[model samples]
Target: MTEEKLQDDIGVAAATEASPEEKSLREKFGDQVLSVSAGLDCEVVVLARECIAEACHYLKNTLGFEQIMDLCGVDNSALPGWSDASPRFEVVYNLLSVSKNRRLRLKVGANERDLVDSVTEVWPTANWFEREAFDMYGIIFNHHPDLRRLLTDYGFEGYPLRKDFPLTGRVEMFFDEAQWRCVYRPNQLTERVLVERTWPGVDRG
Candidate 1:
């Protein structure tokens, strides 16, 4: 057999069929799973908020998606049709199975003030990832041991990744020579209009 044929065979064997994975989720969670996107590169399963923790546990132990590769929050507030949608935040989980060379993704939604259960207990490595999501998107993870900001300063005012956050930001930092430290103050950059002229297809009237 040629090298290319061997690689093709490996690719076929490594990825699990999408149907079985979706079927397994249905067997376990029934309608709690909102949707499944199974692609050649990876598979994604979206679960109800209350089912996230339980589904994570099942995937790690039962489905053999042993590693939690990444976790991040998505702010849908500014999406064209999602402005008024409830559960304004979505957290995506990336799971990898090294033994099988397969990958999966899980997503769940959270309302503005609602908190999702923490998966740190299942995957200890999720500690920092969860904190970063909380810091950037302001999505709370319930039962998280330390839910403080991971990337931002001690008193950062707003969630920087949220679409509504000002492009220039709420504050700017500078070193105060007299005080021998840094201080943050309201942004001083003057706002400038980028587009002064109206173009075709635009309703200027």
Candidate 2:
């Protein structure tokens, strides 16, 4: 089918009712399930950070969401309409139920100092994904066996993906002939112009 047709179908499906999985999750977790909403093509569940591991266990073993397609982090501190009371960071998990032909997204809010429970025990693939999240967004994962930098170097200074990170980056690297090794130095940008960004549909005036 065409992309537009697919999107129309998804919109209709979202409008009709909540998915069976969403109902089950709400019924099971109750207060632990913060919110249930429809995404472009899947159901999204926002869970309390404390019970995320428990919810994932139930979703995998009982609900048959057997595969975790992806796991990533988001920094919402500078997002439009973000609330000051809400956590600044979020960890998102995309799960796929092959047998049921459905997808689900799980999100847990986390503060900068809070440690999110690692899901490596539930899904082994989460090991590297969690490490990458830690490396990029500085989100800590509790009980992760080897939570280290996956993409960045050992002495990387700052989380690159955060909204507050510099556009030119924290440091510059070059091969030093005298030292016979690669060396990193502080960024030497002479000038930077801060630009205000406006969203497409939002009116600033």
User: Who wins the lDDT comparison?
Assistant: 2
TM-score against native, each model:
0.82, 0.87
The local distance difference test score of model 1 is 0.87
Question: Tens digits of per-residue lDDT for model 2 on 101-190?
Answer: 889999999988899999999999989999999999999999999988999877888899998998789789999999999999998986
Candidate 2: residue 190 Cα off by (Å): 5.0
lDDT scores of the candidates, listed in order: 0.87, 0.91
Model 2 score (lDDT):
0.91
Residue 130: error of model 2 in Å?
0.6
The regions of model 2 sitting more than 4 angstroms off are 1-16, 190-196, 203-205
- Cα deviation at 93, candidate 1, in Å, is 0.3
Clashing pairs in 1: none
| TM-score (C-alpha, index-matched) for candidate 2 | 0.87
Q: Give, for candidate 1, the lowest lDDT window spanning 10 residues.
A: 78-87
